[model samples]
Target chain A: MLDTAFEALKTFDWGSDLAALAPIEEAATASHGKPEARQDLENRLIAALKGTLTRDAQDYICRKLANVGTAAAVPTLAGLLLNKGNSHMSRFALEQIPAAEADQALRDALPKVSGDLKVGVISSIGARRDSAAVPALSSLLSDSDPAVARAAILALGAIGSVESAAALQTALRAAGDRRATMIDAVLKCAESLLASNQVATASSIYKAFTDESQPRIVRLAATRGLLACASQPAVRSI
Target chain B: MSVIKKPTRRDFMKTTGAAFGVPYAITSAALGNSERPAASDRIVMGGIGIGNMGRGDQGAFLGRKDVQYVALSDVREEVRDKSKANVDRHYNNGDCKVYNDFRELLARTDIDAVHVATPDHWHAIMVIEACRNGKDVYCQKPETLTLREGPLMIAAARRYGRVVSGGSQRVLEDYRKYVAPAWAGEFGKIKSINVNVGPLPQLCNLPGETKSEAIDWDLWLGPAPWAPYNPKRCSGSFSINGASWRSFSDYSGGGMTDWGAHHFGGATFICDVRDQQPFEVNYFDDSNGKYLAYRYQNGLTIYHNKPKTDQLLIEGTPGEKLAPKPVPGYKGEGGIYGDFIECVKTREKPFRDIESAVNTAALAHLGNIAYQLKRSLKWDSVKQEFVGDAEANRMTDRARREPWQL
Candidate 1:
């Protein structure tokens, strides 16, 4: 039944009868208990992905791989990361793999892809909170494309490490047209920082924006962030 | 319920006093009036995904004198045009701005609040983005499409200090009969309640049809996997069959979440367990068929599709009476919508706050996972994951297509 599904998958496209793929779906669930069965299914799906198949076929396999794929499936998925038609779905599979290999694949692809594709990779990295990729993302802050630059800023914000917060603070000083975007990202970083109990670090980020030189709204957000920091148990302890 | 302070004519005058110097120039719409409050004092509102429910929500807010509905958004041209026409008709002007993208509507700093009635998939992204943009949200039921979204949405709302309310009017209104009795302690020491909902969402492999010019197909499928534009695939119908996006696992949790948002929402409210999630889900597959018993830490159990049990049927200690606890009701005039708007003004939690709504939605999701895995599972509510079950943990959230991350 699984072989029959794979055979039909070669021509599978949007609107195809989904009944032909029932075996693959069934295997995804039935293999949950049997690790060997799960790995075998993953291997078969990865092979089909590497074969000459329709985009729909690849999409289905990637989704299944996301559920059962291990580090073994990372390399093949990463190979498609630069393919415009396949990058998003590849990232889709990579994002949920819960393996360090998936994170490394995304970071490696960051310098290889540009524009929207790069932005997509950056987003996946941020979603994974790949602290190792923070340096690579920080370098993209000044990328020529505003979308790429903004994606980097947002990705850094999502990472929300003390280093990411510092990068955002540095970017805020000369963010030009991206200043508002940077401030929002910086505040997001501060909020996450506060959440992780780095109240003093969050307070420092907040204090930077509270100056009279900043916009009233930015000052208001900064003041609120500072107030939140002050109200923290760590700060209250002192 | 606490006494709600209605904006008196004098109060309106005091609030809109900034235009006192320009009284001669102030029109009826801009000036303080007995029937309609001044425009300056009203909650500036917008609607996203103005479909069937969106239209109803729009009308609810539009009918309110305290709300000034300024904008509308929908992926389909006809829906957007018709909704804008409705808004224009209500205000007697063609000034209601329309957009194809909801982000455009959320970007307007002047817009104080937004009502999101998009499909189940779009709810979390729109709500969180709206909150991030400093706009309060009144998002439709099943506000979360995944377990992970619940916490993120709640956090975004809290961090921004935005008044975010879940759209589940039926939880309190439709289930009032059961709710009142349960809260009144008519059934002493409530044991368990059965909520019958589902036919979990299935994969969508609908044959693609010719793309319609009337709708932005790409925008409509935003963040979801690429699929051919089939009418039934994106239909706004309530049915959870292949006829609508509600039937697809990518977009919804079928009836489990579609109507589960109301049924489970009602069941939890009746059991006074709206704020809690089951600590363990025991799946049963016997001669009778499959069902689930969700055990909560509070000693309350919720049975999902248990055999021969009626929906929202409370199994409790019989004949023994206890002191009645006050049933929480909507704060202001017009049901849940009024509750949301009133909370927006007073900064109070709404009758169906996001946390409680997420909890209800979480029940449907947890049950769906149990059914999908066909195994009993222990859930660590604080961690929001299955205990020691990596396979079950993988089912907690799905990978969204790129450029859209929570």
Candidate 2:
């Protein structure tokens, strides 16, 4: 039953019998209680998910993986996410991994991949709340892909680390046309870092943000960060 | 399909305020005795926050005849009126009250239960207050603003003996149903569950806009620390000026608190790990410019990595992975609301109960504390305090303004 489902899923063009596959797939999962049956179902599902990596396949796989909600497909999903050429499918697969493993897998896969895949990996890692990817993510601030670089900047903000503060400051300084959004990301990151008492790091970052030569928004963010981190007595004395 | 014209903000505010002001208490007697209040009486319900999630919660209860629409509440008067009209139109209860103040609606003794669809910050107070007032609560995900509030809410429910359930509903299904049997054990012991709530994607911050007259700025700012009235905070738009409440610490705990309640809460439920203090809490706060890792005592770690898209990932021993499955006919994709209703009748534990809800809240709060402290701090779940960290401990409970004592 499970093999038949996988075969159907693999050969199944989503435009046609996609609706018909639900019951067979359901039966396979419903019978997942038995050890042998469950493994067979998972194996088939994983194969089907990997087999269907085309645009339609990717969408179908994402929907199927989302419906299946099993860990057995993590490796395949992670593999897809790490595949640099298939950014779309990679992202779709990355979105399907349990949030817990998504970041770790992406972090581990970051150095191994580049370009669109790198951006997808970085964005997915940050989205999964994998703060550990901060170092890799920080480095990606210089990523050639503007989307990836922006994602790195935003991911840094989401991760909220002091380590990434300087990088954000640099990114904020180098930001030419994309000033407002980058500045906002920088300020949000700086504010978060300052609140976390990454003061020394935040202060330096603030200094860069406050530099008169920088954009107006960056300066404002730096000023806010400084004031936010300032002691009450310091504020009163000033 | 009737193409409903969107109501203007001013019109919504006036209609909602007028609807709430009327002494429109709904009596259970109006519904047939079949819907009578009993130990197992079907809970006639009304939905507050009937926008994206509000409609979903309403749909769960609306399908059952045992539950009747009593009222609907939303700050956006348009949403409130539409939701009220929707229930009345659907259930044919033309007289149901459309309320702005959820408190007023909850005040009625006839309302046995209320489904809270407000933002994350409003959840703790609303749930606690609702339970305290004898109304069973079905609150949306990320049950509380902080970990500290979770226990307080659990206590309120326990003390008041109200059926309070969190919105992480995936726990209702037997774990074995979706995945293979061997895959479960192969996944190794539950190692760590990471939840990615948002990639609301990067958007530029806009200058604060003038508060529209249609909005009850004061009411919308309830409980959150006062800030300049901005449309972003109340309008629920992605723009900072429009939805700035999400970015501010005073209003929300960012994505973790907002979506963490759903994604992370799901893992806590599946693993059955409750009230266990993370040995240590640390955050990378890559938003500042770097990605870092937060480690916990149980050998579990949480990462706040940003993803390209919104999804959840769970990693466990033997490298098992679990992601959220789309459960159709299930409330909110995870069936959390439906489970709560079922539990309300059967007196069973919902997917994410008070204890687990508090634990998930604690975890998110710990992340916030770690972000604030800028250093990893030890925690004692039993003590409910940061071990030897006074400043961090201070954050455990927030200062509620007078007249709203926790």
Candidate 3:
């Protein structure tokens, strides 16, 4: 039944009867608690992804793979990342796979894709909060493309590691037309840092925005952040 | 604790007292003499997804003296224009604005708050974005599309200090008969409660139809995967049989979340576990048939579709009596809408605050995962993951289409 569904998936396009895909859905459901079964199902799904199929069929396969795909499926998924039509869905599947290889695949796609595709990859990296992407993301903060630059800043903020926060601070000094975006990203990093209990680091980021020269709302947010940092019970000497 | 005072309408009025006296041709309402608060004092509002429930939510806010409905947005041109006209007719002006994209509506700094009645898929994105833009939110019922969205939405609200309320009037109004009794301690030391709601959403593959120019089908799909725009695919009908977006997994969790929001939300509130989530979900499929028992951290269990059990059936210690406690209800005047507006003004949590709302919605999601896997499961509420279950964790959230992330 699953094989028949895979055969039907080859021709699956928009408006096709979804009933033909039931066996695959059942296989995905039944794969739970059965690691070997999941791996077999994932392997088949990955193979189907590499096969010739309609855009819809590929999209459907990507959705299924998102649930069960592992590192083994990353290379095939990564190959689709540079294709504009398939990049979003490729990243869609990659973002949820929760594997180091998937993160590496996205980071690898960063320099390879440009425009909206680049922005999408950066976002997928942020969604995964892959700290290792901080260096690559920071380098794009001053990209000529405003959207790409803004996305990189936001992605760095989402990662919110000590290094990501430092990268944002460097970008903040010359934010140019992306000033508001930069400030929002910095505050986002501060919040994330504060949540992760890096109070001192979060406080430094917040203090930079609290000057009278900053916008009132920005100052207010910074002040709030500073107050939050102050409220954290200080660590005693061990 | 140091208190930071936000500049409010009252603060503006105190500083601009001279300008009020010099105002020319001011209407009675604008002058604050006709029982309505002055226009400056009223909360400026907008509506996103102005369809069935959106239109009703618009009417509720539009009719309020304390709310100033200034704009409406919907992907479909037909409803957007109609909603704009309704707001214009109410305010006696053409100032009402309409947008094809909700982002533009949220972009307006003047909009103090927004009511989102979009499909379940758009709720988290719109609400979080609205909060990011400094607007309070009153999102329609089933305020989440996936379990992962709940925490993100709650975090956004907290980070921005926004008053986010889940839109489910029925949770309190229709279920009050049970809630009041339970809160009043009629069911002393409640052991468990049963809630029956489901037929989870299924995958949609409706044949593509000629896309309507009036509706921006792409915008309507938003973060959902690209699909052919069939009428039934985007229909707002309540059916869960592939006839409406409610029936599709891409947009909703079928009745499991659609009506489950009301049923599960009401059950949790009645049992006083609205603030908590189940740590364990034990599934049974035997002579009694398939059902789920959700055990909360507080020892109270919520049974879902257990055979021979009526909905909202509370089982408690039979002879134990307890002291009556106060039953919480909506603040201010008009039901849930007023509660939201009042909370917006006071900076207080709304009746169905996002945390409790998310917890309530989590029940449905947990049950869905349990039923889908056809086995028992454990959930770590704090970590917000399926305990040691890789396959189940993957289902916590689906990959959103590009440019849309929490």
The DockQ-derived docking category for candidate 2 is: incorrect
TM-score of 1: 0.92
lDDT of 3: 0.87
> Per-residue CA lDDT of candidate 2, range B1-406, in tens?
9998765322443455567784533455543465443222456676777776667788777766556667888777777777777777775658678877877887775577788877666787788667645667888766777666776677557534567777755434433342332234545555555555532211122334666645565566665433345555555533322255565554566666666665555555444455454677654544454222445566766555533322334465655544443332232222566667766666566556677767776767777656544556788876677888654664565433212323
Best by TM-score: 3
Arrange candidates by TM-score, highest first: which order? 3, 1, 2
- Which ranges of candidate 1 are over 4 A from the true structure? A206-237, B1-25
Per-model TM-score, in order, reads 0.92, 0.51, 0.93
lDDT of 3 by residue, B361-386 (tens): 89888888888888899999988999
Tell me how far the alpha carbon of residue B152 in candidate 2 is from the true structure, in angstroms, after superposition: 0.8
Instruction: Place model 1 in a CAPRI quality band.
Output: acceptable
Q: What lDDT does candidate 3 reach at residue B92? A: 86
- Quote the positional error of residue B59 for candidate 2 in Å: 2.9
- DockQ of prediction 3: 0.55
Better of 1 and 3 by TM-score: 3
Mark the 10 consecutive residues where model 2 chain A has the least summed lDDT. Answer: A83-92
